[model samples]
Target: MFDTLPQHLELIVLTFLLAGLVKGVVGLGLPTVAVGLLGLVMPPMQAAAILVVPSTVTNVWQLAAGPRFLGLLKRLWGMLVGIVVGTLLVGWLLAGRNWPAATPLLGVALILYALLGLSNKRFRVAPRHERWLSPLIGVITGGVTAVTGVFVIPAVPFLQALGLEKDDLVQALGLSFTVSTLALAITLSQHGSLLQADVLGLSLLALLPALAGMYLGTWLRSRISPLAFRRCFFGGLLLLGADLAIRGL
Candidate 1:
C-alpha cells in the first residue's frame, strides 16, 4: 500500500505522525511541528496547505470533547472574528507566491513559543478586561497565523491567562485552533495556494498517519511523564526553530 507513494509522501507522512503525536500528548503543536519541519524542505505556504485538513479534524475532536463549547464560543466570538479578518487580510497580501520571505518570521514564532513553554510563564487576565483583550489578541494571533501558519503565541498564552479549568482550557484551545484552521483554509483558498489537485489529495492522505499518531500519543501520555516530555518537546521545537531561522536568513 505504501510502495506507490511518491518519495515526498513518505516525508509528509512522517511529519504528520510526529506532529499528531505531539498534539495527542500535549493538546497542541500539530501545525507548529508540521509547519516547522515541513518548511525545511518546502515553502511555508505549502506546509500550511498540508496542515489544513488534519488540524481541522483533530481540533474538531478536541472542541467536541467538552461541555463548555457554547460558553467559550460566546466569550471568544470577538477573537474569532478578529482571527478571520486578520488572516484574510494578510493571506490576500501574500497569496499566489512562494513567499519564502515569511519563513524567518515563522522561525521566530516557533522559537518564542518554545521558550515560553520552557520558561513556564503564566499570564492572567481579569474577567472585567476579557471583552477587550480577546479581540486584540485575536487580531494579533490571526495576523501571525497568516504570516507563519502557526497559531500558538498570543492566542495560547492569552487563553492560558484566562484562569479556566484544565478541561475548559483544552476545549478553548480547540475552539481557537478550529477557527484558525478554518480561517487559514479560506485564506489559502483565496490565495490559490490550496487549490491544487495534488495538494488536496495529499492532505487527505496525510490524515491517516496523523490520526494514528494521535492515538499512539494518547496511549503514551498515560505511561509517560507529561512534564518531562513537554520539556523535551519544547527543546526540540527550539532547535527546529533555530534551524528554520538560519535557513530562512
Candidate 2:
C-alpha cells in the first residue's frame, strides 16, 4: 500500500488529518493512528521514520504552549526512565531479524488496545504502583515506539487510568514522545536509518502537512461527540489491523 508514490502521499495526508483530529479531540494520538495505518503500507522501520518528524513537531508545539514547567517536570521522570529501557531493548530485538514483522505485531496491539478503550472500564494504576508501573509502562511505550512508533496505546491507558486531567495528558504525551523520539533516533542512527541529511530534509518537508492536520482536526473535534469520535477511532483501528494481518499473511 505504501510502495506506490501517488497513493502513498494521499494516504499520508489522509492519515495525518485523522491523526490530528483524534489528538485534538482526545489530546493525543498522531502516532497511534499514523503508525497503525501507515504500517500497512511500509515496513515498520520506515513507518517509524515517516512519523518521527511530525510527532516531534506537534509535541513541541504542545509542550511550548500548553502547560507549566513544574507540572511536566513532576510527571516525566518515571515515564522517561521507562522509555529509555524499552527503547534500548527494542533496538536489541531488531538487531538481525526481519524488521518488517514488527508491523504485524503493531497492528495486533493496536486492535487490542482500541478494544480496551471501548470497554469503558478504566484500569487504574494506584499511587503505590506508580513507582514501578510508570517505568514499566514507559519501557513498554519506548519499546513499542522504537519498533512501530505506537507507544500511546500502553502509556495513555495507564495514564488515563491514573485519572490525569486533559492538560496533564497533553503534557505527559508531549514529554513521552520527546524522550521516545530521542531514544529511537539514537537507535536508528546506530542502525543507519536516521542520517543527518535524511532527518533535516524530511523534517522540513513533513512539518506543514502535520500542522495543517492538527488545526483542521482540532476544529472538527468540537463538532463531533466524544462517543462518536471514540467509535470512529476504534473502528479505524480494527480495519487497519485487519488489513495488516490479511496482507501480511
Candidate 3:
C-alpha cells in the first residue's frame, strides 16, 4: 500500500491532491493535469486509471452541491444519454490494442476544443431538437471518455450553450462525468486493464490530496473575479491542449 510504501508513493499522492484541488476549484481538469504530471512517475495508462475514483467522487460532490439535480436532469437529458452510449461503444472498440494511436487523436481533440473555447462564439445545442443531438453527444462523449477520460470539457460547453444556469451547468457536468466514469470503469474491468492492486491502493491514497485540492480550489474561486476566472480556465485548457499535442508529436 502507498501508505506504507516509500518516497515514490508520497509523490504520487501529493500530485493527486494538487490535481484534485485544481479540479475542485476550476470545475474541470483532473484527467489532463494529474495524468500528465503523474505519468513521469508511473506508466501513463496506470496514471490515467488511478484518476477514476477521485474524479468520480469529486463530481458526485459537485452535483450534490449544485442543488440543481432536477433542472439539470431536464436540461441534460440528451447529453446524459449520449455519454453512456459513446463510452460503451468506444470502450468496446479499444479492447486488446496498443493505446499509442489514441494519444495523437486525444491531442487533436483537445487542441480543437481549446480553440473553440477561446473563440467568441461557443458551440450550442438546439435543446428543442433532442431527437438526434442527445444520442450523438452521448456517443461522442463516451468515445472520448474511453480514450482520454477528459470528455467533460466538450460536454460542459454544450450544456452551457444550451443556456443552462450556472448551477445547472455544474450539475450537468457532474452528472455527465458520473455516467461516463461508470461505463469506463466497467470497460476497464472487462478489458483487464485494472490489474494492479498497488495502483488501486495508490489511487485510494491519492483521495485525501484530492479532497484538500477541492477545498483549496473552492476557496480560490471565491477570490477571483468572474471574467478573470473565465479567462484563466480557458487559458489552462489551451496550455494543457498544447502540451498534449506536443507530447503526441
Candidate 4:
C-alpha cells in the first residue's frame, strides 16, 4: 500500500498523524512529537519546517475555540514580544549549522518536560508578578524553541501557573503555540531553511493526515480517560526523548 510514496514522505505523513492524535487527546504535543520523531530520519530543521503548517492550523483552531482571546492577549503581549524577538535573534545566529549538536538538547528538554508533567507539581504565578515574569518566561521559551524546535517546557508550566480555568488554560496554550509557530517559521525563513519547495509542499500535504488524526483522536478522547492517556503519552515521550539524547550524545 505504501510502495508508491517516497519513503521520507510516508514517514512524514505517519509522524504527523501520530503527532496530531497526541494533540487531539492532550491539547498539546503536536510539535514535540512530530519534531522528536521526525528527527530520527531528517535534520531537526527539516522536521521543524514540516511542522509549520500543521501546528499553525491546529493551534489556530485551538486559539479560536475560547472566549478569552482578548484578555489573554492583553495579559500576554509582553511575553509574545519577547518570544518573537528572542527566537529571531537566536535563530539567526545559529542558522545553517549542523543540527545534530542540538538534538541532545531537544532530547533533554523532552525528558524534563515529561518528568515535570508526571510529577504533577504545580507552580503558581501570582497575578501581581505577571508583568515581569511573563516576559522572562517568554524569552526562555523562545530561545529554547529556536534551538530545539520544541516549545513546551517553561512555556507550558508557566501557563499552567497562571491559574487559568481548564478551558482558558487550553486556549492560552493554543495562543502561545500559534505565536511560537509563526515566529519559528519566520526565523527559519530568515535562515533559508524554510524555502525548499518540497518542504513547503510536504508541510501543506501533511496537514490532511494531521487533521484526520486529530478528528480520530478527538473521538477517542470522549471514550477514554484523559489522565490515563496522558500518563501513557508522557511515558512514551520520556523513552523517545532518552533515545534522542543518547543518539545525540
Pick the lDDT winner.
1
* Tens-place lDDT digits, model 3, residues 77-140: 7777778778777777877343774555556666666576667576566757655677676777
TM-score of each: 0.95, 0.88, 0.84, 0.95
Compared with the true structure, what per-residue lDDT tens digits does model 1 show for residues 27-58? Answer: 99999999999888777777888888899999
Clashing residue pairs in candidate 1 (N, C-alpha, C atoms within 3 angstroms): none
In candidate 2, what residue range of length 10 has the lowest lDDT sum? 193-202
What is the alpha-carbon RMSD of candidate 2 to the true structure?
2.6
- Candidate 4 lDDT over residue span 1-249, tens digit each: 112225788888899999999998889999999999987766676688888999999999999999899999998998888888878878888875655578888889999999998888999998899899989888888988888888886889999999999999999999999999999999888766454666777889999999998998898998999999999999989998899899999
> Candidate 2 or 4, higher TM-score?
4
* Model 3 spans > 4 angstroms off: 1-11, 39-44
Q: Any runs in candidate 4 off by more than 4 Å, and if so which?
A: 1-6
- Candidate 2's TM-score reads 0.88
lDDT (Cα, 0-100) at 242 in candidate 4? 97
User: Lowest summed-lDDT stretch of 10 residues in model 1?
Assistant: 1-10
**Whole-model lDDT, candidate 1?**
0.88
Q: How should the candidates be ordered by TM-score, best one leading?
A: 1, 4, 2, 3
Q: Say which prediction, candidate 2 or candidate 3, comes out ahead on lDDT.
A: 2
lDDT of each: 0.88, 0.72, 0.68, 0.87
